[model samples]
Target chain A: MTAPAAVLDSPLRELSYAEAIRDALAIALAEDERVVLMGEDIGVYGGAFQVSGDLVHRFGEERVIDTPISELGGAGMAVGAALTGLRPIYEFQFSDFATLAMEQIVNQAAKLRFMLGGAVSVPLVMRFPAGSGTGAAAQHSQSLEAWFGHVPGLKVVQAATPYDAKGLLLAALDDPDPVMLFEHKLLYKTKGPVPEGRYTVPIGKAEVCRTGSNVTIVATAIMVHRALEAAEVLAQEGIDAEVIDLRTVRPMDRETVVASVAKTSRLVVAYEGVRTLGIGAEVSASIVESEAFDYLDAPIVRLGGAEAPIPYNPELEKAAVPQVADILSAVRGVVRGTR
Target chain B: MSISSETERCGAQAPAPGRKGSGGSARPASRRAGKTSAGNEPFAVRHYSPEVLREALRKMLLIRRFEEGAEDSYMRGLIHGTMHLSIGQEASAVGACLELTDQDKITSTHRGHGHCIAKGADVGRMFAEFFGKESGYCRGRGGSMHIADVDKGNLGANGIVGGGIPIAVGAALSAKRLKTGTVVTSFFGDGAVNEGSFHESLNMAAIWKLPVIFICENNHYGMSTSVERSTAVRQVSDRAAAYSMPGVTVDGNDLSAVAEACHGAIERARAGEGPSLIESVTYRWRGHSKSDRNRYRSKDEIDAWIARDPIRRFAGLLSEHGILSEEGFARMETEVAEQIAAAIAFAKESPDPDTAALTRDVYTTQTESVG
Candidate 1:
């Protein structure tokens, strides 16, 4: 079950990121009786973002429960259920609402096992439909993966493509500790090839989506696609840019980023979070702290979200976060030794 | 009277008149009189067997001694950090857990030593945890505030107020989903009632009809602020009506009173009747913590509560019923004292945890090589 042998022989089919996540949920529900799907409006209403479409009907309301609009209570219940015997997969309607449940996420779920001297493990998975792009305004569109990444007992992961989304969601179920999967709302409709059966992508592992040598562009979630597009444009101008998608943020894939930085000699971190104290800062710190610092030919550049909150206006929301143009300009600046 | 009517009667009299005296003993004498009589042999004395009653008294004594021993150790500088002592709230802890078996689960508060002991945790390991020894419940990772014996069905004692409320509801949810036949009792104070987690958790439990008992050990103050100053509702249990669950308030100092209320709630929960709110109205004799100066309340109020000490009252009740003699009670106290002394010695002798294994239990599986 650990290896993707079924994935190898099974016919590959294109699935939207949301559909892929739903597939993983369906597979988990069918395979394990202990797996329960819980969230607000996830039952007959098909979830807030329609990620869990018709799961409650197929799995029964008892298994795929529609909890009251109580994030803190619901999340804490998932943690408690995980502690005892159940493997609960909880979904937050939007990542911004996580602030309401931070006590359970940060204090209880993250620290329960450690606080109890490893006597118990919380095999809890929380899916957050994160990032801005939808005109959901300041409350619902902010990218807060960095907040969970800062926690010690949590495993934070971001899936850029449909394949990784399903694979990572499956891997999170296999994990014993609490794993937080940050699924970007913008990428939910994006299509990619996903396997038919159960398969897991290792947490804390980065994938080099596009390989080059002039500069390394480290990105996560939606920014990974932007960085890849920027790399394609950079290749046309004879500048070879490497794009590395940092899958996990807490137990960060520092070795992969460090090695990529060592080979490229210049680094550009592109993320959708705020500029200060964001994922970019952590990636940059890992590079400088490692032996890869000696290979640097230019100062590192970070293409992150603006310091302001995500606005209701589409243009302002697009300007608030990094786009393909921002990643391209940042990578060009790093490669040309201008940053 | 029926248990429901009795609960309603007590619930209506909450914030018991003359609770705050003007520099003198304003204790409510009528509420504490004739609790144990030949005809009305309190709920626990009548319902429980003589052996169970004896055990309940023993556990109540153990809780009291454990807190006293912990306080003594802290005073001697043997235990580091601060502790919220539950010295005077022993009956609420023990009575509420009187019917619970080893398989039953409980989530405790910061002042949780009583709950931990009542739920059958070894005192030796609890002491070792206070000493920060490797042989402790949490292997020195969690001290007094976070002590837990998971295998014995104690989830943990939460440092944050109302933090364990939702977790307890979740545990009850697991019990219902997995058909584990486990009922979870979540212990929090009066102050935690105002927390959003409390309201949210109660509503969830009530809606799902989960087998959980929400035990509020209403010891007046959340640190220094009294319930009257902090809470809008007169009684903590009164808030239960909002969530559509049966709410009851009992004299927490009376072992049978608390046990009776909790027994009804626990039985209701196990029968798939959903959750019930039980407010065990008691008081803490000592200051909230070691740093407290007792400035918030008068010494007379503290003295008045001490006069109605749960352990003494329970012991006297047992003697009055011919379940245990006065000499037997003295022997029980001596036995608990010796046990506590032995526990302290074991804790002092326990080995310190190696610094190298500091981060060993942070994650069950080593996902990352980096700290």
Candidate 2:
């Protein structure tokens, strides 16, 4: 059930997660005439995070459309375009803005194909800059990947690294169904080696970011980066924590996740979203419902964001989601039987 | 709030109460602003050749017979799932799509069978879809509310009221960007115009000058709630002013009038003048769904609208003009009835979907990396 590591041979470039996403968009735009970008302030404004810098000039305003400040309308247009012939990549200023366009995303884009008896496919990509730590407060900072993953037709993924941010975006664009790509706001500036040119990391395969034996920590979005950092700290403490970066939340690679859990009996699900009914719950259930259940040596634990809105206060924002120290301690507790 | 607006006193094809057309008394002093004098005229359909009018009549009749057939089948329990038939609003559906080429796209509402038929969908597959047959357009996946033919440029009908508005705008955006010369027609109902999606889509389309025609089939009800109960504006087209687009209200039962208004709007879109909103005020003779009894509406109200049946009115026009003889009209009606009958037979004989289909079409197991 294990997939080969998606190691690209193209020229390696150190790019931030935001830069990798922009590059992937540029590649998709250049390679195909059907692809177009639409979002608020993404064109001349260089995006909220400057992710799509100068794309307006390069692709022109036609292909790189600067839509009116209407998320619902823009998302609906993207669905319509996807329903017709063109492939549209829509961007939400923040993941929270998606709430305004929930009807379009949930009812229209997600259900069009199935509702139409599979007569058409909505080959649409929606980019959501999600997660917290920027002190954007309750309205701005939120992880709603689980909300979209809960839908039957949507392909929900959390791009953890620059390589994945680029590769997953391309993969999502290529996917025949609607794909919700959630990029953590904090990871925009985090740099990693990303391959150049046309390449994609298949959706639904969880990659083992840091392979270990004592415990398995399934992390999503920014938590994967945090889990990797926590793994380094746990390595020094003699606890080898296997970190599985759950790239895609839905159509979950249960086989890969179960295999990791079977390999490492102790399991810890880490996510920045709220713990209740989150991706962590799904991951926890995946192992509990399978043969991996009998292999569990201890009660599987979950370390996720607290059941509270992300506060504007920096300290509270840091406390909201599981930080490296929290992930490190959670794994330590599960591994050393400290409870 | 009263469900009736000042202009809600008449049926789709009826002349405004106490108001006349071009030859009648001068336009009302208190007449709702922004509506054109030309939009109130029913003779616009005569501007086209008799041939075009005959085809428009044929299209409307086809929708009428098709829905009647569907209704019969539904009653017989041959159709599994429920459907929203455009029984009384045939003119709006036909006229909106009357002039559209195969390259142009359309998105319909839950009451979309007429839209699909107008867009050249094969009735056999459409009936098959309603019967949940393997041969249906959606292969039994999308039933009545979900029938779509991408090849015919029908983007499929939406279950949500204002759902198709944005999609039509998107198709227009695609057309504008690709220089495809493809205009998109969006067909919704009175209830949909109030939806936030309508406002957002109109604003975007107006600003971008996307080739989109927004046809609001104002059937006087969003389920059971009337326009006065739902909207602040008297005419659904009045909302268009907020988005800087041209808006009009036309008699939806008059196919020629609906066709003429849509023709202007479609041409305006193709010419890159931006989107236009046309409120084709019509009525649904039937209930909202299979379960909906006529509790909210009075029997008199239903009878009044039914008297202005779009197909019957169009047939009268064609007959009056000598474009279609009485015999020809009867023959067309009989042919459509036979077509529906054949479709039902095809659906009844078709096999149920295999178990493997359960796991199929769900973007199954893609391991290949995109290059």
Candidate 3:
């Protein structure tokens, strides 16, 4: 058996988003006996997305538990276990299944602490395989991080990079309130540098993925990748597009986005969630609500998924959310003042 | 009071393992309050002493008076939000907690004031919670349905139907995993039995044999809809057969029957015999909520259920057993009324929650680390 990965400060080896999450799970299981993975098809199936691969064999069925296909029951049990001594990480095969567990998540988990006057807490973690482009259609491909972020007493984070994928999970495990961690379905196989052993990426912080001056593209999940790609293309056109990967949607890094918009004087918010009441509106409002409003050179362009439910067809699906080309066109329009 | 008469009323609905009754048996709890304790034998048939009987009556009485006061205050514009009172279903609520302690956990329904009181919640603080004051259990953030005293083993009541069912299963899971010797009871409305959570949680609990009891307070109606109209199944407990668990339906208006049934189920759960379901057939005396103007049910139907008021039946049982006299019952009534009145005054005098407290309890640590 491989020795549990050692703690190394220096970055070494690259892992895909799926592998990074598994590494974090291994660390959590090995380090803390109280941690358990509760979800459907996560154990023998190695997870529907294969994110929990091989850990079930190592941790045993008790720690890496397989649950019935009842999202409401599984999620509620996770919350209840958290209220007890156990730190349970619940997984939804798809983010859309969270609709079934909304009563437990929104009503029970979110309100338990406040309802009890802070006597007890639900130190629970819920993972969702979110975002579109898999052609999983409307039910499986939704990015519902905004729905969770809208609720109080919940910490919602989107892991874009492999480093943050592992680090943010470890951090959420440390949190006392229920935290919802959203991993983009499209970014599962995407690989990036991840440190060895356990490490934590601070929640509610945004990282500047690519620095530029013409426009600041604040993106989440898979949108961060599209924004970075668009920045690369715009760099050749003498349009230096700054990219800010907004990792956590709730308690957003308003200071960083506002500061970036102040410097670039233009902003383009990108996300895979529906256009109405998406994170884009909040980011734009935060900037407008602050001193960044006066520094805006152009109206903030919100690039979100289409208002309609995603069609099964791949072409229509591609048209739903902002792509690299769409980001480029929006950035070009704001930079050239053509709109 | 006699064995033959007791059997006549409760039938074979007790959780005696081998006991079974005809499907949908509706036993009318004796509405006659004059049946005094003279004809009953003491300490021979039941183990509970005269003191325990008095205490049970007292607890149910307190719940009744407290909720009545809350209703009065609501009408007077003192209690702000709406409250769902279990006035007529006190036995089903209190009887489930007869054998439970702080080591045990109970998740209650929206009509959970009785459950909270029966489980030893402070009446003053509960009143404060209903009034939305700082001294309440939730510090005024959560209203009637969300009121909780976790230290007392009362998990907060849920507003959503069937929401607390899974949490109870999870708690049972924790007890089993930790070997804590703790048991959990989930008290939900009849409507919740139809929800997916109820089915899923029951299945999981039965398979694990985790010490948990699913108690369905079958109050005959969910909001305005009758159980017969809403659900296809004739009996709520029959669903337990799907999970391979023992399902018992008892006369909820009879406190002794509820106690006997819950005590056995809880003991079996604690013995690692998995979960069981108890469908306590009862009725609600009040409207579903403040907005419920009693438009759906006729006054005659409401009067019939009110005739079967659980508090009155228990009072009759105690009187029939010779444990309670007319003067003794009257003194108990006055005592409960004063206690409720004091609680109301306490809630009225309590300060409003500090606005600064609203920011707290959101997370365990760190506001937002920008770096």
What overall lDDT goes with each candidate model? 0.87, 0.81, 0.84
Clashes of each: 0, 1, 7
Ranking by DockQ: 1, 3, 2
- Candidate 2 lDDT at A321 equals 85
Query: Candidate 3 docking category?
Result: medium
* lDDT ranking from best candidate downward: 1, 3, 2
In model 3, the Cα lDDT at residue A21 comes to 95
Task: For residue A99, give model 1's deviation from the true position in Å.
Answer: 0.4
Model 1 lDDT tens row, B1-371: 01111222211223333232110111122222223344565777678998998888889888888888999999999889999999889989998888888888999999999999999999999999998999999998899999998877899999999999999998998899989887999999999999999999999999999999999999999999999999997678777789888777667887787787788778888999899888887899888888999999998888877766777777766776788876777788789889999999999999999998877878999756563
Greater TM-score among 1 and 2 belongs to: 1
In the range B16-68, model 3's lDDT, one tens digit per residue, is: 22223412322222111112143543221274777878888889999988888
Give the clashing residue pairs of candidate 2, or none. A117-B142
Candidate 3 recovers a fraction of native contacts equal to: 0.69
For each candidate, what's the DockQ? 0.82, 0.50, 0.54
Q: Candidate 2: lDDT over CA atoms?
A: 0.81
Q: Estimate each model's TM-score.
A: 0.95, 0.92, 0.91
lDDT of 3: 0.84
> What does candidate 1's lDDT look like per residue over A278-304, in tens digits?
998999999899999999999988888
RMSD of each: 5.0, 5.2, 4.8
